[model samples]
Target: SPFPVHINRQQVVHISGECCHCLRLNNLGIFRIHCHGQRGLIEAKIFNLSVGNHYDIGQKISFQLLESYEQLRQFPLEIFRTSLTILLTAQLRLVQERIRDLIVEEKSGCAIVSFQLFEIAAQLPKNEQVINILRNLIDKQAINLIDPNRRILHAICGSLVIGPKGESIDVKLFSQANGDYIGEFTPKKIGQYRIDVTCANIPIQDSPFFTEVYDPLQVHIGPLPKNILIGIENTLEINLDNAGNVPLEVIITSPSGINVPIKIDDILTMKKVHFTPTETGIHYLNVKFGSDIVPGTPIQMMVNNAHIISAYGDGIHHAVHEKEATFMIETKDMQGDLQVDIEGANSVIKTTIDRINNSLLKVTYIPVEVGFINISIKWNEKDIMNSPFTAIVTNPGNIY
Candidate 1:
């Protein structure tokens, strides 16, 4: 006999399963489970299990079956999760590296230009308006690539180049000083070169000035003593002519090759030099310049000033503080008269001198003439010292 009962109204549904001690194969197998709440139906599969040595909950499963299920489900899922984590980490690292590179590049550009956005946006090819604005700025001399302190005013990590034929591009600001800038530079291999202009960690843009180096001025030795005797003091006169516009400092080296400073009053003109040589016997006279001298022009000379003038000539000339002068005396072996003229002065004194002894003779004053005091001595006819022993005469006022 079965009693009809509504599980929902009773709030319970009970099902009973066979105990582990049962022996019959299908002899009255009763499975039972208690159901509650909104759904009161007991499911038969909830408590179904095969009879084993121990109760189903306490049964020990084989390692092979457990390991197979783990490999097919949990183990594979764990491995897949680990692989996904590794891939995500690698992707994050790559993205970080790219971001770092971009930051470095941006910093480099910012170090040259004050406006970061201006430089970055100006580089884009699609920004035609920006390019045009930059062009106009250059034309208006609004951008300066050089500073007043002789520093190169750089753009955003780059240099400017001018072609042979094109509009005059101004890289300097309008308030900058106007001057000529010439640059002729070339790299061995074509590559990008960075230019940076920074002041107090901030960047500034100015004019682009260029410089070139030319052939240095050379020293040509003219008339000098070929053989130098030892233990004798020699006087050397170096003639220097500046061939370049740039002023240069002359450096005369000694026996130890130590450079000594030489004064240059004016570099664009010729200069006369006079110095005494200490050592003899083929001493090397090395001359250099602190700055670049004139290119392809005679800049210096090394020669003995003593060999050109006689040691007794200064005494025979007079008390006149005049430069070395040449005189012409006509003597036909007997006697003759002469005339004298002075430059940059109104006085001229004519005097006769001995041919063999070269003693001074009495003379009178003359009218106004050039500063050059020229005197002519004459005899009958005789050749002395290749031409004549004509000597420079001093002004009467210069007599002591």
Candidate 2:
């Protein structure tokens, strides 16, 4: 007869055969077969004591007739149990019906298997040799829906760490109330750190990630000029000497709530931010470092339009014909091109300008053709205060 069936759980069965008979389960060293003979009938069971699910599998149990105790020659059970040259077949055939017993799949980031299967494999009697041979082709299994509460084994887990080379930092890893896993690490120094994750003595997917540490406190911003002029290039310098490799953000808002475009240049070791204010009113400046506001940020700056500049000297009023006319211009901290225009002169008017200092320039022009020559001076494309001075020119007719 084929092997008996066990479903959901394990069952023990009694076996009796004709006199001088023997039973053997071939190639199943793991399956412990218990045999005992009484008078004319022999009794034996081939398999371990176990409990499983939906396992109505019937395997062929080969039987062979042997000379009774007379053939055993006393102590039959001992001698026969040791020298029972039993060679059984290792073939799995559906003794009767074709049934779908188990379904193997992966779900929820985990491999799903019958919970009862592990129970059977880990049973007592310690049949390691046989179980290993037939582990993949196990006896029976049940196709059950996934149930989180019936977790009999470990749910795939891993560990994560972030630190510098050969130096580990403190990391806090926890699960939130919403069941989301979160990780945090505090770096002690400003350097590159490696993130490692492992599971079951093996590296998990995407094991290593890199990160850098930065200190926002080391970022410093210099003082901005409280007063600035419109249409003039004003610059602010920022010092990030001790700060790590991080980014700095700056925003300049005009009086009309418009964001002014600013140019940032790296000058030696400092950052120079240059912006030209167009509106004459109160403007705001914003600065930040890695989502943290730097000290003295969002400062207030008053903007004033360029006013008329004053000019004086002998070159603008009276001059002798064919003589050089000279004048001095005070820039008053103003910036732009220095221009000079001479009118009422038919001949080309030659002009010369020499920069004496940061805010002073010397202007010279010679008038060959004279007719009340009008002179005009403009700074930054705009005329200065009291410009277009008229100069009297008279030819020195036949000077001695």
What TM-score would you give candidate 1 relative to the actual structure?
0.23
Cα lDDT tens digits for candidate 1, 216-335: 333333344332222233333334432222223444444555443334334234444333444322234443332433333332333222222111333223324333333333222222
Highest-scoring model, TM-score: 2
Residue 267, candidate 1: alpha-carbon lDDT: 26
lDDT of 2 at 353: 90
Please give the range of 10 consecutive residues that has the lowest summed lDDT in model 2.
Answer: 19-28
Tens digits of per-residue lDDT for model 2 on 1-400?
8999877533221211121121111111111111122111111111221211223432211111212223223333433332222111112221212212222222222232211111123333222332333332221221111122332222222211111113444454443354233444444554344444333222333434444444566767765643366887777788776554456788999989999889999765489899998888888989886545776768887776655366788878877788888988887665566678877656557788998888888888888875788888876556667777888877778456
TM-score of each: 0.23, 0.39
The superposed Cα distance between candidate 1 and the true structure at residue 398, in angstroms, equals 27
